[model samples]
Target: MDRRRTLRQRLATQRLSAAPLPRAADVVRLLACVQSQERDHAFFSLGLRSRDTTYAAVRAAYDRGAFLRTHILRPTWHFVLPDDVRWILAATSPRVLRAMSYRHAQVGLDDPAHVTRSLDALGELLRGRAFLTRREIGAAFGERPGLPSAGEQLGHLLLLAELEGLVCSGPMKGVHHSYALLDEVVPPAPALGRDEALARLAHRFFAGHGPASLKDLARWASVTQADARAGVAATLAATPGALEEVEIDGITHWFDPSLPRRTTAGRAAHLLPVYDEAVLTYPAVNFPAAPGHPTGGAVDPFWEPVIVDETNAGLWRRTVGKDAVAVETRLATGLDHEQRALVLEAARRLADFLGRELDYREVTGGPAADDAKARRAAIG
Candidate 1:
């Protein structure tokens, strides 16, 4: 199989190499839910998918409830739409909670009665106001007697409220994210049945992050591998020919058949955000490396990827100063003249999205080994 062709096809399907969407909201709806832990990077993740958009514009849409950021799809922050939040959480939160079980226990937050009280309190508190930051909510929640509501414990309780559909992302209060009752944020959404929910989720995953394997689905959604298989099967059976399967070596992958099979002409580079859909949505990406090379060093979500012609040639970090945003590249492989130009242009794209001047730099290394190791261990 031609690895370049496969990679390009997947990138195009991810909307990275496709014609840009008109608006940031369109981008989020297309991707189902985008990984968005870093608020700035999350805004860029949406803005970069559009033809031309600014951080202010994207944040405006978010404040308008175009999408609601919350804990979903594998126990991390994701920008899920209000239309999608309830069903997606219902389908995925159990496994995420299981993954978070140790941390939940560490915070002494697993008690059913205690959780109910916290949620009830949070719901009532948020119902009184349109929005409140985490710290604001935490302080008030701490006032309630016999409830664990401080530090990591408060954070977990908020996460629980999110998972239980009691609250979602509220309007940005200054620079900090706030939370409000889900009911006030969006109209009531009836829950979907288990099988139907699974099928809808599977369809969204494969359609949005397609040319992906069952393992990718399971890993990304924190569902069981078997659950992933069942969802994929049901989605395929329910909507015949929506997805097409292809075999590269011995691995089977599925993608939306309607998306272009060929990438647009010319070499391209993208300053993909940290936890970018193109970079982190799939664990099965096998880039065209030299013989016997293991894999691209991309599992670290902390380092944003520098994609040069569909290969992960490096990781990048950004430093925002008053006048300009400096983007520094830590390269594992040297870039040719064309690739160097592309990477510089990609840096410019980030600056444009952030509405700042570009200050670019380069170096010769990947992410710190200890950082990647500890992160992988933490997630595992």
Candidate 2:
């Protein structure tokens, strides 16, 4: 597929241009897991994915453990389903544990003997408490002569606890997140072997974030390139018709064959969060033909994106004030009448998600921004 089709196909696949997913539960289940380091933006990510899920709704689901937010997949936080957590950790934890070994030592958690003892103590601390905030846990884990007592080292110790499956996220304790015993919160399911776990994760990634390449899978999951290829290959071998590949710019792209090749019915607009799976899952994302857009994947991969019909037309950010949320858009390209209106609608959608009044502005700065401003002025 060419760049235009590639971008459009991705939009459809990620449910950005197509009909949205039903609810927060469906969203996490379908996408496999969502990267959610930015807590508030992560809620919006779920809001954006669903048909009409509000921020309140997402939070409610989270409070009930409909999905879990924890440190997984490259050391950042992700919202993974409870049942999927065990298998995914079984597949990826060894790599993650190895990656964090230096931190483990730096934090005085170097002794596996002590770390194991710490987990035992922590498990005892959390056993029937239902949930405890990290700060609360830290206090209970008072100063020990040789043990990690407080701050980063202590935090790493807790991180190790999480990786070991001793605990997982509890509901938000008011605005602060808390932790619960994994066995208490998560419903039990049969375990999966490492190879089977990898294969399952591979299938989910392609189904939700596809027309993607093997390299993308490796980077996102923090698995070896060889493991990623093996996982994808296993999925291909098991269900040949479930997946298909195409050469986009000479690179092989794997995708679920069941998704239709279509874009949104009209000019759609979005304020996709930074690290939203739709944006971060792919190493390089193609865009529609527009001035200032790179012919190749041009998104810088850091900023929040302003999308119009599968194109990252510009960038955006939100500031939550007392009474209203301020949404500012920096356009890199011109928008026509309908496109401009669609962007406003998108901003309102965000405001509605936050249950706050809309305070929207389009700021102009650089040459591209100035050009876009001039074009919008002319159009008006």
| Regions more than 4 Å wrong, model 1 | 288-302, 365-380
> For residues 1-380, what per-residue lDDT tens digits would candidate 2 score against the true structure?
77668778877877777778888877788788899879879888888878646888999989888899988888778899998888888888889999888877777877778887778877888898559888887877775445555799778877777777778899899888898889988878898877878889899888888888989888888889899888888888888877888888888888888975576556578888878887777656554534443222245433467778667777777888878999877665556668768888999989999899999998664334334665577679
Off by over 4 Å in 2: 143-147, 288-303, 366-380
Q: How much lDDT does each candidate structure score?
A: 0.79, 0.79
Instruction: Give the true-structure RMSD of model 1.
Output: 3.3
Clashing pairs in 1: none
| Candidate 2 TM-score over all chains jointly | 0.90
